[model samples]
Target: MSSADDPKTARQPQPPSHAMVGTWRLVSYDVEVASTGERFPAMGERPTGYTIFSGEGRVWFMLTGDGRQPGDSDRDRAQLLETLIAYSGRYRIEGDVWVTAVDVAWNPAWVGTEQRRQFALDGDRLQVRTPWRVMPNWADKGETRSIITFERAVEG
Candidate 1:
């Protein structure tokens, strides 16, 4: 068959609303400072995370840094909390952007807030990015843009 007629090659890009409905595994997460062009890992060089988009308009996401060990001390608990992010809520796709209305979040401050991310899809990979915003816990650090990439999870 001609390449243009092949199923894989012929598949057109789906709308974000349909294209995003699946489980995705985190590949990388980074942040770039607007002022200096300096880029750093939002979590770590090897962060771990999952993002799930349902056809029913529900979304769930979680992410954490690597090398975490259980600790009973308050310091450890604080460290743990600092290294993790999680939230769940309804989502909608508008143009090329995905907006999430947070119903619940690990950080209480995020609850009831609408988070927006620009998205791009290429085959099995998806990249979502945040517009420049002051890092929540580090407002003095200046504005930052978060970039996160994910690969569609394979069903077992």
Candidate 2:
């Protein structure tokens, strides 16, 4: 008898296991922030940041500018250009959906608030899109709602 005849062998091959791990550049993404139900810019617009991802189910996000332009004082700017927003979690495929489980957050305060980023990739460009509306309580006094695109950055 062949393995194909076994019941377990009938299961479809799981999506490549190493899919979610890697230094994926933010190619493009559309995000929406919450507010007083008024129109506003999408998330990742206020400040540009890079998401450092790993295969070990880890994520670290760091920002530099506010999309305006770099200021003088290279030293001061560099000083404020980084943050260790480290987190750990697991992700896998559930039928046709890519389920993401966020278990940890850099900011302990956000430990309980979980977020899911539904995204897809093409070549070197990655596009992350969300249907849910979000609001930044810190920025704009939490008055913003929008969907934006994030483009993948070319690695040097």
Candidate 3:
């Protein structure tokens, strides 16, 4: 049987009111420090990623830093991992926030956690911001929040 015909792989119809249900291409990803009000790109000047929200209430996200290079040593591999964030699971929308009950994640700690993102849609652009918290990737930066933007992908 085809994957789309399977109950587990089939996507349920999304409600017309669910505006965020679609595929989006990453535009920019930045991190902001709560204390100093400093903001910088999370990956680099031109990070890349994609996020897909299905009518079946599933969401998948994979983002990578700009200019990622292959590593030759353990340290290099670790750095590569640090520059990536990926997760997938069921999600639900609440007001302007979307929460995902992550079933799998690049970081094991996020596997069972609910990740919440506050988002705003403007035309074909969607901007998302995470809550301020101490991030493992940039703990030394203190409480930081991710500010990401995505453009709705056009299906030609």
Candidate 4:
């Protein structure tokens, strides 16, 4: 039989919504000043985090290791950051929207922060959209633009 006559290649399924539910590592992310679109000079090409999605209506995402936490004295920010990762919360999907109720965060300051993350996943590309700066801590120095994009993490 010819290659086209084989059944393997012909069995590939089209895009499916539930295909996105799984553990996905950070592929790449774009960070800019949320309100001004100002990009960080040092944020050249490094993204930090892992996201867990469950088709049964659950999500756990953690983003960390930016290397920009303030000093401990004037700002206890560094200590706080040193102790915990970005944020992880419970999430659910409705149609094409992914909403999160921040159940746990590194900093207790953000324990109650609720967020809405819009997502679109096709093949290996996964994108999440938000409208808030990454307030690293409760006493964020200021607002900083942040968005996270990821691709499928290969696993055996």
User: Could you list the CA RMSD of all candidates, in the order they appear?
Assistant: 8.8, 7.4, 4.8, 10.3
TM-score, model 2 to reference? 0.47
Q: For residues 1-156, could you state the per-residue lDDT of candidate 2 as single tens digits? A: 788897787784443454444554432223344544444333343545566455544555443334544547887555443322345555554443444456676556656555555555555554554444434443644533323234555577
**Pairing residues by index, what is the TM-score of model 1?**
0.85
Ordered from best to worst lDDT, the candidate numbers read: 3, 1, 4, 2
Clashes of each: 0, 20, 0, 1
lDDT tens per residue, model 3, 80-136 = 997899999999889989999999999999999999999999989999999999987
lDDT of 1: 0.89
Instruction: Summing lDDT over every window of 10 consecutive residues in candidate 3, give the lowest-scoring window.
Output: 8-17
TM-score of structure candidate 3: 0.86
Error of 4 at 100 (Å): 1.2
Candidate 1: pairs in clash:
none
Determine which window of 10 residues in candidate 4 has minimal summed lDDT. 137-146
Q: Tell me the lDDT of model 3 at 68.
A: 96
Indicate the TM-score of model 4: 0.61
Give the winner by TM-score: 2 or 3. Answer: 3
Error of 3 at 130 (Å): 0.6
lDDT of each: 0.89, 0.47, 0.92, 0.63
